[model samples]
Target: MFVLAVILSLVTAAVFAAAGLAKVQGAKQMRDAAAHLGIPWDNYRLIGVAELVAAAALVIGIWLGWLGVLAALCLTLLMIGALVLHNRAHDTVQAMAPAIGVGVLALVTLLVRIAA
Candidate 1:
């Protein structure tokens, strides 16, 4: 359980960090996504910051199980919001899959950390 938790946490952190950095750096894709989702650029950047913070927490949580749990939960919620926005935009299932997948990873991380 501990090993699983560590693996999941690292993978989730990597994914979120990459995504967050893209948003923070104002990548073309992220900007387009924000516009598509009707989110303001500033608000989208703040969301990116939130992701980065959560990712950092997950990394730091390697030795601190509680923080890992909290970070995973946060990521899960973020993903939920992403899903909602995507849905509101009438996005295809394929377009929403990333959020669903990452949300599952975050959820699994949370469960594993708790078990560990």
Candidate 2:
């Protein structure tokens, strides 16, 4: 169970880190994508920062147990929002995969911790 939590946390961290960096470095692209999704550009930086923070929390949480659970919850919510944004942009196929993957992994990590 501990191992599963560690793996899940690491995977979630990597994904969020990449996504956050893309949002930060590729602001124009992110803005375009957000526009397509009907999201305001004003929110882009905030979202990027949130993702980066959440990713850090997840990694740090690994050593802190319950913090990991909270981080998982945060990442789960972030993924859910990502799915909604992608869907709004008519990107259902692309959106579903990562959203589902993250959701399942987070859920599994939560369950494993609970069982332990």
Candidate 3:
């Protein structure tokens, strides 16, 4: 269970870190997507920062059970928000897949850690 949790945590951190950096670096697609979602530019960047922090917390929390639990929960909530934003933007299911998948993984990790 611990090994599984670690794998999931690392994967989630990698994905979120990449995505957060892309948004922070002003990737055009991210910008356009945020605009399409009716989110302000500043808020969009803020989301990137949040993702990065969440990612870091997830990775760090692996060594700190309480933090891991908290980060996973937070990431799950953020993914829920992402799903809502994508829905509002009327994005294709393909575009929303990552958030859905990641959100589920986050939930699983949180549950696993708690069960441990």
Top candidate, metric lDDT:
1
The whole-model lDDT of each prediction reads 0.92, 0.75, 0.86
RMSD of each: 0.8, 2.3, 1.4
lDDT of 1 by residue, 43-103 (tens): 9999999999999999999998789889999998888889999999999999999889988
Candidate 3 residue-wise lDDT, 12-93, digit = tens: 8888888889889999988997888899988999889988998899899889978888888888898899899889888899
Better of 2 and 3 by TM-score: 3
**Top of the candidates by TM-score:** 1
Off by over 4 Å in 3: none
TM-score of 1: 0.96
After TM-score superposition, the amount by which residue 28's alpha carbon in candidate 3 deviates from its true location, in angstroms, is 1.0
Compose the digit string of candidate 2's lDDT tens values, residues 52-109.
8878887888777787777777777777787877776678675568667876776666
Report clash pairs, candidate 3: none
Model 2: weakest 10-residue lDDT segment is: 107-116
